[model samples]
Target: MKWLVPSAFMAVLGVTIAHSLVWGALICPFFIFAWVRYRPSMKIIAICVGVCAIFMALTSVALSGHESHLTGEEQRLPLRLAQPFKIKGQTATTTATTVKGESILVKVYLQDEHIPQLIASNSPAWCYWKGELERPSTARNPHSFNYRTYLWNQNTHWIFTLSNADDFTQCQPIQLTIREKLDQIRQQGMNHLKVVFPEKLQPIAKSLLFGDRSDIEGELLESYQQLGVIHLLAISGMHVGLMVGLLWWCLLRIGLTKEKVRIVILVLMPLYAIMTGASPPVVRAVSVVMAVIACTMIVKRITLIQALCLSIIVQLMINPVLLLHVGFQLSYAISLSLVLSAARILSAKSWLESVFIVTVVAQLGALPILLWHFHEVSFMAFVTNLLYIPIFTLFLLPSLFLLYLFSFFLPNVTFLLAGMLEKSVLLLDTFSMFLSTFPFATVVFGKPSHVLSFFYIIALFYMFSRWESRAPFKAIIFLLIVLCFDWFSSRFNPFGSVLFIDVGQGDSILIDLPWGNGTYLIDTGGAVQFGPQENQFSVGKDIVWPVLKARGITAVDAVILTHGDWDHIGGTLDLIDYIEIGEVWISPSSYEKETMEELVMKLQNKFIPVQEKLAPFSWAAGNAYFELLYPHDRDYEGNDDSLVIWAKFGGLTWLFTGDVEEKGEQELLSRYSLKSDVLKVGHHGSHTSTSQEFLTKVSPTYAIISAGVNNRYNHPHPEVTQRITEQGAVMLGTYSHGAIEYRFRGDKGTFQWMIP
Candidate 1:
């Protein structure tokens, strides 16, 4: 048991980073050194090393075939539906459904899948879908969520899309089991709560009771995250603690012995865990609580840390993949910190002081992982937590839980309780929103390297351990120095970069200036679907926001809409809503003006003025400048009238020709010298643009083509490719390389492909 936690933890870590051997190599030396210094018996040392190696091997073997099972020319395979096929998330045009059983996570995108109909008729079914199983999507850009790794960690390695009803090869419904019925009941409970609660309180109820967050508003959730009180939204140890305390008090009053009560609670906790979907954080919390109870029941004098270690070992043994979950790591990390420091912290004079101490310790403990995973820290978290924790724990949590309980067991009382909770939830939400608006509520940092993150953990633990005794000023200084180093590296680096973000068959370019002067964005990518559903997706929210937030970009100095084309300008409104914009510029367009006018009005509402018909001009700042080159005393409809921009910085010149065609290029060449070091290939390299005459005049060292992979329009036309090759210019396409970046300093520049 003593060795179990470390061995299991290391083995899981090994499996997660199976592609890298360096971690295991580094750990081996430490173990060998310890053995030599302590002079442990050779047999004991060998046994310890053998146990670790075996666990690692077992984990690797279990994961090795997961990918292969989905591939290798396997056109047909069997999949048992986990439960009644339920809709997970549905937009107007598409429905996202999960089919999980046999430790697999299969996302089935259904326009009309026969499996759903079959499951509707018969709740349990074994079905074979005819299609190649696709590997889940991996992140192709910085700070983007890795859906592939996430699914893999959840034992889901492949996705199957059902475009039509005929995709189903075979379907056979079997009788349901007790577990399947329980899952059905749980899902039905979730749906019932949504119907029973009011519109404003529905999300809060769903999250608090069932741990489902699909219904929460994006802006409200972001506010909670910024305020660093987002943990209140998750169902974790706090909720478990509340339930256990209530149950213990009730059972003892009923004349139950301590051991009997502990056993009863232990038995009930697992059932509750299952009902809550067995999330890694909840399971770990329940295990830890159970361990503590078992220790007390057996009259064993076990420290909280020992019980926590046991809990970790038990959870890992149940599911090794849980180690990869961020929630699991955070829960265990925070819980262990509290265990280690609880005695000292709780020794504070007042309850308020104790709460303050606890909040600070939790933040310090979670800081390293938060920085590594999120690339930001909420400096105001301690203060927000101090104020919010009591309201959330004492009032909101109990109210929500009681409502959840009464709604299930006594439906009559649900309305009154829900109505009361609704007001409290709204007030709490408003407070979070108000708190989020404060300057520097959260501070963004660069993603730390592993060594630096590890050092941060060590320094923080030492500081907390020594804080109440001697002053730990040195630790504070060390942390500040590290933070300042990262801040300077991110904000004051002399090399500027232009990132051509991959937004699939559309254009979005971000120009990041050196020394934190400002960032300029050209074109926000967009997609429009016209049908009964009329579903719209914005690249600003899905693509641009993640990229910018990851890099700590909070404000834009300028936004240039190349034209009124839907593909280029549709995301403008979303971007304005998600971030702060200084100025909006639109080029001369002979196209319809309704959509553009509406967008302009929205920006104006936010006190942002939109400038139209930006004539040929130059603006300089941050050691660089851009000159508007085209639309000079001429206006034509569509692509020919696209905005043209010329920028010079870091000893290099680049031109952004937004969808300009052959005629526009000719006029451009006739008007001025068109030489540039880098050229954004016109009109996504359509045959209609990048004329041979124009290529000769430009003589660009590199031509960048932005297009979608396997798009209907075969972009970078063969003739254009030949013309560029003839001119001896290298061509890079977003279709192949994902997001392409160019960094420059002095006369030297380097290029990097995000997905290549």
Candidate 2:
């Protein structure tokens, strides 16, 4: 009963944190009242208060330390904005500088920027502007200097970065001659070694070695997610634990004493964590495991739960922001659940029984949290875990150890071990794919509200706790209630309408009709001209698919790609592969030699029809009507050839104009009298499009802009925003609101705006 009070309060606190609030204001009073009314004892109260005070103090200290490292110049507002400039230079060297209590680093670059019109009256300023002794000259002039001062908010438009003497320091020039030699080796590896490896093996190699995933396609990532095997991609406690165990075994076999083996494992685990980038979650996991090991050797007793809690306290004290990180939350929550629940499961003598118990307990504990965050439940996760956990822990982890150990001395052994691991991975992948293809293996429910999610979690907890008791009946009833609520909630979907998803600096729109009649997806959000190597499909998988699944959208009637531009169609390939698309529509002019063409070929092999710009054909689903409005034969360039669309439901009208520029906008205005209740801004509201004249012609009451936050191009430019505002139109953007919806009330002759 005493534990329930704190547990309930902590659950509320967790909900508040997920909402991005600084504190749970509404729930804090309850916690305070509990603390006072319970009146456990002076000693217990003092200890709890002392712990909280220490935590707050530590957070304040960390934040203050971070602030002190910033330059005085950065603290002040800019006197003037400098013109955008590009510099050509390479990273010479980097060294971490400890300032106050925070880590600040200075990067030395041989840069070439024009002499400033106004220079600061400081010694370093002159040295920097004149390229003096403080400034080292390199092969390339005007090199860019990028250094980490503090964590930049990816969500903010204008981030303050450190400048001037407070945080900056000059370092010795690094020679480029050595860099040239390293470049040659990198090029050789890319040109030859990359070609020799099979395409499917690349993701495993990247995940195991560098933790990079630029090469893994989005569809495969979704497959892994559906198979409940995404944890394999991330370097987690399981991987580290396996490594430690392998190291201990090897040391003991080679004649090391028990104490020596423990010491070696402790030292080697941290080293491996560092090599893997030492993300906050990984660091916390390693620290907790190490502390447990230490306690076993020295103190002779310590509860795993206590060790985990202590590790969390240590991590939170170091960086309170980590408490807000999703990965940190998931890792700790899942691990803690296992620690608490695994003991309750009946102990078994057989190895298979032990494995089954562990798998079931962990999966049961993690399922609620997983479903709450992702709205996905893999029915085959238990079996998948049973099959892969042992393989991953025993075979793959040992292979990694062997590869690292024999790489230099017995180079051939590394390749042989890698080959075996690759083959094993291929086998596991095939099994996962087969399981994924099974009917009802994966279920996706739309996003659940906090209250519903809480109840669902309670139901799961109840079910797991009383699986072998009569209480299981109560759990089933609770689940049925949840299902009924979900069904009713889903009934309120804005069907037979077009929705502009707010996926900042990108475009993703959804069109839904009643009775599962017609579902159409316009452009999946993606960058057009930036980070060319980044696949839009991966973004679609991580961002779009989850949203769609949550909304109970499993199939699309038509995936209308406006053009071949990355922003317009980058995610189309991945979406086509993951979801059932009846047909694909694109502008004929978009047949450029790009990833889109490769996507078309893939779809063609699957017997999915791809249609180029057809005449303004009308399509109907119940009372809703849709018609293509542009991309006639006269249009040539991909941008101008965007598939303009008009949709009408009841009295409501919506228009979707792809990234058409001023010329296209003017042509549309000249050609047609476009009137709509809602409009999706063209070219992301760039100056090149969305002319006032065009907006006047459209006469839309609500305008939606799909763009990213703090985009490089500054999308939805100020002037464009001003123009929309001037028209007395309600402007909604994805950058601010994740996804926007509109529901038409036919009887009232009005519509409602919604954000989910």
Q: TM-score of model 2 relative to the true fold?
A: 0.68
User: lDDT values of the candidates?
Assistant: 0.75, 0.62
Superposition error at 580 for model 2 (Å): 2.5
Task: Name the lDDT value of residue 298 in candidate 1.
Answer: 77
Model 1 compared with the native: what TM-score? 0.88
Report residue 56 deviation for candidate 1 (angstroms): 3.5
**lDDT (0-100) at residue 601 of candidate 1?**
80
Q: On residues 1-756, what C-alpha lDDT tens digit does candidate 2 reach at each position?
A: 133223323543544443344344534554576678777776666555555555556555544443433342333331111111111122222222222322222233423231221112112110121111111211110011111211321111123322333322332222233333343343333333244344556566556544444456555666777877677777788777766776788899999998888888787666656556566667867887788888889865656676776677666655665655667767876776677663445467888777777766666666656765666677677677777777776777566545645655765666666676678778877776777777666766656666666666666666666764535678767777885676445534444455676545667788776656668899887633322233432556555665677665677888888877777676776565457889988887576647678778888998899988754677877677888888767445867788898888757788899888788888777777898888898988888889889988888898888877678898888988999999989998766554566644441244333332
What range of 10 consecutive residues in model 2 has the weakest lDDT sum? 138-147
